[model samples]
Target: MVTSFLLAAAAALLNAQEPRPVEQDGHVRPNIILINTDDMGAADWSGGGSRFIQTPHLDQMAAEGVVLTDFYASANVCTPSRAALLTGRYAVRSGLARGVIYPHSDYGLPQSEITLPSILREAGYATQIVGKWHLGTVPDAHPLEHGFDEFFGVPYSNDMSPFPLISQREVIEEEADQTQLTARYTEAAIDFIARQAGREQPFFIYLAHTFPHIPLYASDAFLGQSQAGRYGDTILEIDWSLGQLRQTLADHGVAHSTLIIFTSDNGPWFEGEAGVRGRKGDTHDGAYRVPFVAHLEGLTPPGAVSRAMAMQIDLMPTLARLAGAAMPDDRPIDGRDITALLQGGQESPHEVLVFFDNDQIAAIRTQRWRLVLRTFYRNWLVPLEQFGAVHLFDLETHGDELFNVAEDYPDVVESLSARLETLRSELEGLPQRETPLNLPGDE
Candidate 1:
């Protein structure tokens, strides 16, 4: 009787450790791949209205998956947007809202915060990051310490100085070849996926591409092949990398069991078309709005288009749910689970979306209206001046944001302004850190 009871207990423990299968559709653990591009605009892809550049693979992915039309980045810049994406919280909450982190800077995403990979890793998934990190370069703040099992990429943006190629904390190359970065990163991702091909344990790959940012570079094969010049060439290379990843997944027989997401970190900086006013640094719709596409063989409907409003912050909660991972209950998560919107075209979970320019409240957007609280040109190239103190826009009628409807909708303005103030007060109550000093030419 004693031996029998001990055997029964062992079996129960093993069963509890096993992840649910896909057919059950309850807490199924599928391989997740998040592909993030740097400084890509909403209109950079052919499906998103790029006439000069051809992004056939990306267009094909959109046609065969779900396309999010009104998706937004958490912030108009890199460090803050990335922070919000990884933590499921506003960048301001982590005190990383002032500007992008420079190589010489001594700070990064706080160690106390929980990251997406950390949660997924705890749930039995092998995690890897294969491109630009940009979060932090210090030893304590490296990607390896942030829950990623492996890190093979540059520490920051390619345009930054001393851009070396690193592999698990070791600088392999003093200066990595920019031209071969996309190809090399794709190879690394394919290898990682192939290793997990038939394994019972699921995997998560964050293939963050470092191209199309600035000072763009493409391999010899694609150097002069685009009508839009070097910028277009880099985009074409990125699209090719996507096709390669898809083929590798199919080859490994894991295509049916994987979830793939493709999006940009922020808006275009100088070259790409944002399809709206302003570029990367401004608080306009163009800077925050970006292209978002998701593909899951058995889940997302083919060619489905969702105009539901969502942000980069939503990825944490949504992915955590899909991965059967528990979120950190000790802190607030600003992102909402967008699973319904992704699978069934349901209404957005968020009633109002807030846009931040660094730590300050810049604007707020509802389903049909947008209220701009403060407006100033933050782009370094553009002259600094106050465009206005407060303005309201009817996005449904005037999507261009040219007309101010504040007088027509006084009540709406009053409500949104109050909401902004409430948020400001809440942030002020949190413990603050000294804002990072912006370095010259760092955006």
Candidate 2:
């Protein structure tokens, strides 16, 4: 009798109209903490990008987690790139076409756009942004206005310092000292984490460190820890913050449950940091490609390195998926969820990345072949922003050179020219591209 009833039940369930949901355990979700530094490079540390600078915190995280060998940042400028990250769509789809938020422009990230915080918060995570919210500096263009539960830091760029900055909904602190501001950001994050911990809720903290950007400053402890001088000393302070954060999580017994990420917004400031081409607005590999590392106690594998094509835009969907957030269905997203690789699920992922400096220049890279349009990496964000007019190069032989990527592969150049036109037409014509801007939104 029992066997007969069981057979009937199985049959009924199989014949049900809707397929069973892919059930993800939502019991104890992981907390997320993302760290984004300004204008840093891959080799600026001991791991992948640089051999000189000592980014111990970033390096340690790489050793204990996944290191993307070829992660691209999509756009070469700060504003467009950041917009791409928040929306998970190309920046061109929004009104921002180039470098960053205008001084007093009211245009910020369109409210209708979907951001990582919106998705995660919907999934029950307490999302807060603490540091360098460069999406906009307008009255309505704030992180809280987007989706963050709290926002405390510069609404514009760090170079815009020595002026009042925003704190959540208002400009509470203006022309705040760099050291004090950073400490406050860290303190805010720690407090946010503590509050979340007390409530036993998952929290998403975006600790945007404004250190080592420019007009560099440091507290007494890190005043002179490096032979590299003030810049190096600034990095030491950054490291100190990381150590403290890690310890804070551990002290609160949430270290094993918190995911701490360390990375930069872009390559090192070219003018500020020597031996690097293109700093703030160049399209060179150095400008758009920055260091990225993700580490968590239970989920991430330690000391892993991956050469897969990763980008800042991918973080949106990845974090949302990890947080079990409901994704928006209104618009198309260019980012992919590489949770498998991050969790040691796969050694490699299949995806290509598109990079654009500005409307005048662009580049695309597949697994091996790369197409460089007429643009060098050493342009933009300067007093006189000059587009390189037109130049192409083969990325294979000229990976180190900034200006000539097509000199060797004439075939690649021709292929890229045709390919680029097709891509541009397709991306531009997409209905998801709602707010067309004067520029191609850093293409």
Candidate 3:
């Protein structure tokens, strides 16, 4: 159970979504860094048993932090997954369901929504985001409008049109050198860290790396460095970026006081290893279950492994609580604060995790049971109940999802299906899903 203090804190968020004085919380305010990787696999790290990909820096962080084994992204794609991570609400609730937004799209997260950086910034933290801002590419929908003090990176995916690098909406490089992206993003992050080092204010850095996704590119320094080919080299470069971040923090004498979280936007793509059945863009097991690690020297126990079912949505409320920032309570928040689990709670905070492949409900996962309602094949939706059989897998016994036990666990399937129906009902009542801007060629 969550402590009374946390419960009260959560209650307080309903009134004012701003930072309160930290006297209620016992610990001093700590700097926070959220590193979100793109299309990286769950087992891509050396510590997680990567055969060819080398992620030594990530392995070292996991060795020194709590590794969350069952962490999941809210969705399987870029835009919606990022939306859930930033807003703590499902994309369906925000009307961002269906498909990814494009450069030509006029859509973005609603301005009424309060994002993670908005609360952190209100808490007297210098909030900045340095990497792919795939949520929206337009000027009005840029990170600056979404509460980030500074933004430096591409507006959309590296593969998107224009492909220009920007610094707070101003184009820095047209058609950014994709090969040197990892290194450049790292340099920008280091610069941000160095600026924040001597300041008295706590900092929140959202460093979203845009590599290991596809059309793989590597810097000259790491061009021929990995045995796993180009993908391996790209992962190594990202690892080096992590090392640089750690070194910068240490050099600035703020290593222990900073809480750094490393996770992926979703699962791996075709080239990267998923270690499970499906790859990116799918609603299957491996698609949304990405790697997650949290590091804070005295606060988080080193070398601890947590099997608690957590998600990217949880970060907003959890980080806000740690920073004494109040969350917005006007809307329904899908994320729950899992600080207790991070501190060594055995039980999971979540009763059920609903998986959204874009906007539609794809699956729901409980502690040991997973009910897959539908599957996507060749870009076509296949409703299991309509066409064939609803699939259920015992995650504990079948992590790879090799066996279907829906018939054996009829009661469990019924309960999960009922819950999924309830969730779907809520989504269905929303003011219709928004249409994304057409991709360049499609337009």
lDDT by residue for model 3 (198-317), tens:
777888999999988788899899987887788788889988999999999888777866789999998888833544778788868888988888887555667888887888999999
Ordered list by TM-score, greatest first? 3, 1, 2
- For residues 295-359, could you state the per-residue lDDT of candidate 1 as single tens digits? 87556778988888899999999888877889999988999998766764748889889888777
Q: Backbone clash tally for model 3?
A: 0
Worst 10-residue lDDT window, candidate 2: 18-27
RMSD of 1: 6.6
Off by over 4 Å in 1: 1-26, 271-274, 344-346, 377-388, 428-443
Q: Best TM-score goes to which candidate?
A: 3
lDDT of 1 at 75: 92
Candidate 3 residue-wise lDDT at 368: 91
State in Å the error of residue 433, model 2: 14
List of clashing residue pairs for candidate 3: none
True-structure lDDT of candidate 1: 0.82
Q: lDDT of candidate 3?
A: 0.82
The TM-score that candidate 3 achieves is 0.92
Clashes of each: 0, 21, 0
